[model samples]
Target: MMSYQKFARDVGFIGIVQILTSLSSFFLLPIITKTLGAYDYGLWAQINITVSLISSLALMGLSMSFVRFLSSETDQNKIQEAVYSILFFVTVSGFLASFILYIFAEPLATFGFKDPEATYFVQAGSLLILVSVVESISLFYFRIFRQIEKYSYFTFFETFGKLLIILILLKMGYGLIGVIAATLIVQGIIFLITLIIIISQIGFIIPRFTYIREYLQFSLPLTPNSLIRWVTESSDRYMVTYFLGLGSVGVYSAACSVGNLIQFFVSPLQLILFPELSKLFDHNKMDEVRIYMSHSLRYFLIIAIPAVFGLSALAKPLLSVLTTQDFISGWFVIPIIALAGLMAGIFQIFVNTMFLIKETKPATYINIVAAVTNVLLNLILIPIPSIGILGAAFSTLVSYCLMAAFCVHISLKHFKLDFYYLDIAKSILSSMAMYFFVSSFTISGILELFEAAGVGTIVYLIAMFLIGGFTDHEVSLMKKYLFRSKVNPSTK
Candidate 1:
C-alpha cells in the first residue's frame, strides 16, 4: 500500500519543482517580451500554440496509454519493449508531423498568423514538435514507475537551460527565431541525455512492435479528446489573432500567461496523481483511490484557490512588472484567465476517474461540449470592438467551468470521494484574506512584486493555520518533511 503521507510528500516536492520551473518562464517572459516587443512576441506565442497542437496530434495520445497500460508493470523486459516501441513509433510519426508542418509553413504563416515573413519561424518551430513528442515519451518512463526526483530534476534543468540559452541568443539580437531555436536546441540536448539514461538502465533492445497495436487501440480515441481540449485551451489565440491582430493577441497572451499560473498549482498533483491512481485501481484498491482523490482534490484547491486570488489581486502590477507598458492594457483579462485556470485544474483532477475506468467516451463528449462552447463564444464575443480580447479570456473561463461541472458529475457517478466542501470554504476565506493583504501593497517592480508575493504567501499560510485549515495528519507530515525525519508513512 502506498501511504497517503508518502503521496503527499511527493506532491509537495513536485510542487517546489513546479514553482522553480514556472520561475524560469517568469524570467523568460520579460526577456522575450521586452526584446521582441508586442507584435513579435505575439508571433512567438502563435508559434508555440501551433507546436502544442501538432505535437498532440502526432503523439496520438500514446503518452496516456503508457500511464494506463504500463504503470504497474515490473518485468524489465516488458518495460523495455513497451518503452522502445512507443519511442520508435513516435519517432516516425513525429518526424512525419514535422515534415507536414514544414511543408505547410507558408500557407499557415500567410493565413493563420497573417505574417508572411513568419514562414521561416514556423518552419524552424516544427522541430519543437518532434522534440516534444519523443521527450514526453522518454520522460513518461520515469513518471510511470514513480521516479519523481529524476522527473522533477530533468524538468527543472530543461526549463532553466532554455531560459539561460534563449536569454543569451535574444541578447545577441536573434529575436523570435532565437527564442524558437533555443527551445529546440535545449529540448534536443535534454532528450539525448534522457535517452542515454534510459538505455543505460534498461539496456538497449530493438522493439519488435508487439505492443503497439494494443496501445494504439486504447489510445486512439484519446486523440480527438486531446484535440478538443486544445481547442478549448488554445484556439482562442488564433481567433484573437484573426480579429485583433498580433499586438492585441500579444497583450492577451501575456495576461493569459500570468493568469495561467493558477494551473501550475495543480500540475504537481496531476503529475503524480494519475499514475498512482492507475496502480491502485489496477490492484482493486478502491478505498485507496478514494482517499487519494479526496486528498489530492483538497490539496489542489487550497493551493490553487489562493493562487487565483493572489494573481487576480496582483494582475496589473504583475503584468506591468513582467512586461512593458504596451502589454499592460490586457491586465483585466488576467483575473478572468486565472479563474479559468482554476476550473481547468478542477477538471483535470476529476477527469482522472474517466481515464482510470477507461471511459474515454464520456471524457471525449465533455471536451467536445467545451470546445464547441469555446469556439461559439469566441466567435460571438471577440469581434465586438468593446469586448475585444477580454472575450477570449471569458471564453476560456466558461468552457473550463462547463468541463469541470460535467466531469465532476460523471466522476461522482463512477465513484464517490470526499469533496470536503467546508475545507474548500476555509481555503477560499484564507485566500480572500490573502487577497486583501496583497492588494494593500504598492508594487512598482519585480523586487516589489516578489516581496508582495512572499508576504502574501506567509499571510495565507498564517491565516490557514489560525483557522485550523490543515488537518493534524497534514501538520505532522509537514513537520516530518521539514525536519528531515525518516518518515514511516504508515505510522504517520
Candidate 2:
C-alpha cells in the first residue's frame, strides 16, 4: 500500500490529464465537422486513420520495449543507451515509413480514400507519421521515468495547442489541409521540446546499439500485434469508404470519434499502469500486480460503464448538436461503438498479464483472430443496404467483445485477479438508473446536454453511495488521491 501510494497520486494526476485531453478532442470534433462538413470531414478522418496505421507500424513496438526494459533500471548510462538506441532507430524507421506513405499517397488517395484530389493532403499528412512516432517515444520517456508533471503538462499542451491552431486555421479558411498542417506543426514542436528536456536532464551520448537486439527480440512479436489491432480498431473506416462513399465515411467517423471517447477512461491510466506493473513484476511482487490490476479494472468499469450508458442515452441529440443534421443518422452507431470501447478497455487490462510474463505470442495470435473476424464481418455487413454503416459499428463491437473474451481466458490461465463482479453489477444498476433519468429530457443544444450529464453524474454518485458501491479502503484512497492529503491508514 505504502509502495504504491505515490503510484496512486500519479494515477490521480494523469486522470485529470485524460479528462482535459478528452475535452480538447471533443472541442476539436465540432470545429472540424461543422467547418468542413461531411465529405471533407470524412476525408480528414481517412487521413488520420492512415497516419495512425502507418505510424504504429513504424514504431516497431519500441515504446513498449522502453517501458519493459527501462522501467526498473537505475543507471543513467544504460537508460541513455536504451532511450537513444530506440529513438535513433525509430528515427530511421519512421523516416522510411513516412517516405513510403509519401510516395504512395497518390494511389492511396485515389483507390483507398476514393478521392483522387486528396493526394496532396495525403502527402502532406505523411509527415504526421514521422512526428507521431518520435513524439510518442519522447513522451514515453517522461512516462517511464515517472515525471508525471512534465508528462501531464506536455499532454495538455499538445492537445490544447492543436485545438487553438486548428480553430484559427479553419477560421481563416484553411479547411482540411489547415487541420493537417496544424497537427504537424504542434507535434514537431513537442518532439523538439521533449528532446531538449531529455538531453538537458541526462547528458547526450551516441547510442551504442548494445541493447537493441534484446529490445527488438522482445518487441518484434508485438509489432505485428499493432498492425493486427489496427485492423480490428481502425480498418472499418476504410471498409466503409469502400462499401459506401467518402461522405458516409465522414458520417461514420464523426460518430466514432464520440463513441471512442470511452477508451479515454483507460488510456491515461494505462500509461502509468504498464510502467508501475513492470517495476513490480520485475521484483517478483505478483500479489501487488494482482491488486493493482484488479483495482484498476474495477474503477475503470465504475466510470466507463456510466459513460457508455449516458452516451447511449444522449447519442442522438449530442450528434445533432455537435455536428450538422447530415451526421445525425450516424448517431445510432455511437452506442454500439461505445459498448465496443468498453470491451476494448477490459481487454487492455487483461492483456497485461501476457506482457508481465513476457509471453507475447498468445496476445498476437488472439488479435489476429479478432482482426480477421473484423474484416470478414465488415465485408459481409457493411455492403448490406439494410445494415449499411451500422454494420460497421456492430462489427467493431463484436470484434472487441471477442478479443476481450479471449484475453480473459488466457490471462486467467497465468494469473487470475479478482474482477469484483458484484461491484460491477452494482455499477450496471446505478448506471441504468442514471440512464433512465437522463433520457427523460429532450436535449437540443450543448448547454442542456451538459446539464443533463452533470445531473446524471451526481445521481450516479449518490446511487453508488447508497448501494455501497465502493469499499471503505477504496473510498479512503479516492479522498487522499483527490485532495493530495497524507492520512495515516492506521487511523482509518
- Model 2 agreement with the true structure over 1-492: per-residue lDDT tens digits: 226667767887888888889888878888999999999999999999889998999999988999999989999899999989999999999999999999999999999998889999999999999999999999999999989899999999999999999999999999998999999999999999999999999889999999999999999989999999999999999999998999999999999999999999888779889888898889988899989988889889999999999999999988988899889999999999999999999999999889989999999999999999999999999999999999999999999999999999998887778989999999999999999999998888888988999999988987987899987776666567666876668645
* lDDT for 447 (candidate 1): 90
Q: Which ten residues in a row have the lowest lDDT in candidate 1?
A: 483-492
lDDT of 1 at 473: 67
Candidate 2: where is the Cα deviation over 4 Å?
A: 476-491
Error of 1 at 367 (Å): 0.3
Model 1 CA lDDT for position 265: 88
Per-prediction TM-score to the true structure, in the order listed: 0.97, 0.97
Residue 259 lDDT, candidate 1, scale 0-100: 92
- Give the number of colliding residue pairs in candidate 2: 0
**Alpha-carbon lDDT of model 2:** 0.91
